[model samples]
Target chain A: MDTQGTFRQTVEPALVRRLQRGELAAFETIYRRFERAAWTLALRLTGRADVAQEVLQDAMLKAFERARQFRGDAPFAAWLRKLVVNEALMQLRHDRLHVIELFDETHADDDAPAPWAHADSATLDRALNRLPDAARAVLWLYHVEGYTHLEIAEQFGRSTSFSKSQLARATKRLRELLAPQAEDTPCTIGSTTTA
Target chain B: MHDRLDHHRMTGDASLAAALRALPASTPARDAWPELASRIRRRRVVRKAVWFTLPAAFAAGMALTLAWPHLQRSTASPAPVRVAMQSSSHATPPAAPDIDALQASSQQWQAWVQTLDRDGAPLDGRQLTQAVALQDRIGLVDLQLSAARNPSTTVGLWQQRITLLQQLGLLHLQPYLVATQRPASHDHLISM
Candidate 1:
């Protein structure tokens, strides 16, 4: 189901061509190029630094080993990103990360709205971290990551309604989290600088 | 003020997504290149091993396919083996272990397991699957025990039943003891 495109959509045909030849240097070049992006995506989805590290390593290894299977219709970055996403999701399933985090339902909200536009980056980041892993994954996948509800439902092995519900609840939780400081901070929705 | 609030509200969802997209990207504290390189090398090694071994395995299978009928024809028919198999059901070992102790031990373990399970502690999927399998094995032994004609066979079946019960008991008991930090029993039934 995820075979469509779980990868980041960045095209470099020459690099991909070299990659299909199984060149070690090309593999390393791609890794260096997207290491931060892939790692960031994995970390946000998994919410654990150690798990994200493993996901990055495993995703890179998988991409390198299976490079010959690249069809070239999509960008090499997207295929690699798919591997990273799959690896991160596998870790979540293996550890049942969301089950442990779901024990506390006090922060869950089903009818809440997303007022995150007014929250500063630091406050929003903190609140995002505090959201349960599943809800956060749903929110990120649906909103920023350009994942379809159907795709997300397939990834999580749930109904599309499940994805919709999680996003709704996650937005509500974010609203509640930022409610106390909503009036204090003026936030920017612009691009972030490289860390 | 009302007009401004309405404008922000209309674009709230889009701005929220843009805000999410703009959240900072982070680099992990540790570099993963060494581990990744090692994994790549290890996988290549495995792939090479498979490539080397696969043809040899295929040749072996082909050779066996060619030789199997001749081997079968040349060898004498295994009438003795068939007879032995037929007679195995009624045969019993000479010295049967004590059925009383086995039955008693099995009962005790079963009682302990039942009591523990009745307390309503959660069992994860793996442990629960194992428990189900152990019970199935015990049921099989019970079936054999019922059909047994000889005391030796009955005693052997009872021994199997007790061993299975012990394993099933441990499946439930291990978690409880670990949770409670109680000392565990390392030895089998003491008397027998």
Candidate 2:
């Protein structure tokens, strides 16, 4: 991920043209550049290694086939990310796993500082996977991917309210998942709550 | 390029978002490239066949359609006009290449070379020098063709122009051909 910023500066519009003309070498260079980001996003969104790998492949193939449609209005990375998100969401829809039920986390604090701030990636990753597909997807798309509520709504074919609700529920659920316990388990990260 | 919404504005999700952003990029356990490459090759082959076959089939169908009435007329009545047409066609026997066809092909190749160059086709230093020399030669042929010249001399110059154009085009095309052949190793990607 640290390496991506330097490479991103080098992705000229000419490279996009080469990709539009179906140059495999151009595409290969691009794949090597963004492979990690694409794979990571795929894994986070789908919460399954196999599905994430397949999504990455399908997203890349779509990027190749639809290169002509890239009007250069957005950065190529953003366009590719959109493709990954679309494919992963489509996979969720197909699997019927992206249901957004209101998570009843009444015990979760609404005002307290986020206990998850210091939680390690592995801890957050495990907790994130426990979320309902829709809520988790909305949260990731909203907070991490930097998608707007309207954009998230459009992608999921839901209302902005639906996006807002899912994000709130997912956030509350994560707080509970990371809330303080009687003893710090081996995998337990720092807790923000006072005993 | 995303217009990042204010996660800070959204009820204390800032810490959560920061943590997510801090997560390291992940990679597959095994390289997923070989399978992707095989799929790309298959798609390329299918696309190439379609591109070739569509124009060919269209041309064949058009030729048949245009020839149908002529065929029926000749069979219905072998008129004197038919004999005259047959005699005239036979008179133009296959000793020389058609000048007009050669000129058309030369123009198309010249256009192709120019397009590739405009698209920044990768030609190394030596190849670039050769391309410039070839283009100069083709320009010289055009200048000579405009002078007082016999039919044979004009044909010869046009043929020379076409040959030069083909050389330049092939030079411009070499990088793409090499790429399509698929390198045995991608260690060079590190350099790229």
Candidate 3:
């Protein structure tokens, strides 16, 4: 995860090799290396440092306990990230309501034409905040973790269809919120990133 | 504008992830590493002692019981002669201070056992009973160990406790841990 300097060029590959050979030092190094990455993800998702700490610690301990099961087909970081996300979601579920609902019944927007959108960063942030917790979680998992809908569904304890619906709805809401700032050419469909 | 949206999502997500990753790591209530390793060593020692002394203890007790009848039949005429023979043949080595220490420790253990009977929680259900038994057995070993004065005995008891804890799935209780944010990955994509 932390592929900085010598870790990427030398330490990482060596550690992986040692891990494959079942060496203790390798395990220690790996723990130390990715500890920060794991902690960060947990903190952001949980929105509390204390909860994040708990989740991260739990994830690492589990990883070590199940280290033997690590089939190297996927990078260790990916597996570790999945574990962290699951932990974060579990914490969230415990803290709040299970199913989240988001709707604006007053404004159907069916008759109105889609407007240009180029909202300020603050406005976009608020729009993201306005999304339901479940949708926010899906967006983070997809846009951040880069997980597929099926993976998100599996990890987040929802159906794949639910995951797809959440993402589509989130993107749609974001577009509408930022519509006032749209450029003359307009924000291209399926080109949310390319200006 | 489109590029800006993409940038917004990317940076916003990263910053959020970065914030999330900053959470501190917590130490589990019970660290399984030292406990596990120590338990493994203790079990090995216990097994070794059990392997050696069990058969011998059984055989010695049986031999004494079988000879009891024969000794009773010869008791009248040769009682003093038999006593002298027994004294010579069965006399153990001189009492060592370690044995005395062991005895004292066993007495302490007896007190602890009495306390458990008096104050320890009643383990009602079957599983609970087994858990209690596992812990109690460990305590019993400590008691036996104080009187036994054999270092090996202590090791054996420790090992047995470890085995029980392992079987109970207590060792794997803390499976997950903490870490920092991971960079977003780009690989396979699925649409459903």
Question: By lDDT, who's the top model here?
Answer: 2
**True-vs-predicted CA distance for residue B176, candidate 2, Å:** 26
Write the residue-wise lDDT of candidate 2 on B61-117 in tens digits: 465446445434434434566556656786523213355655665676676667657
TM-score, predicted candidate 3 vs. hidden true structure: 0.43
Candidate 1: residue pairs that collide: A7-A78, A7-A82, A8-A78
Order of candidate numbers by DockQ, starting with the best: 1, 2, 3
lDDT of each residue in A85-124, candidate 1, tens digit only: 7777777766765573433345443234455666777677
Name the docking class for model 1. incorrect
Fraction of native contacts (fnat) of each candidate: 0.59, 0.43, 0.01
Structure candidate 2, residue pairs in collision: none
Per-residue C-alpha lDDT of model 3 across residues B5-67, encoded as one tens digit per residue: 667655554544443222233222333345434433444444444444335434433543464
TM-scores, one per candidate: 0.59, 0.58, 0.43
lDDT of 2 at A158: 76
Candidate 1 A-chain TM-score: 0.81
In candidate 1, stretches whose alpha carbon ends up further than 4 angstroms from where it belongs are: A1-11, A97-115, A181-194, B1-10, B75-192
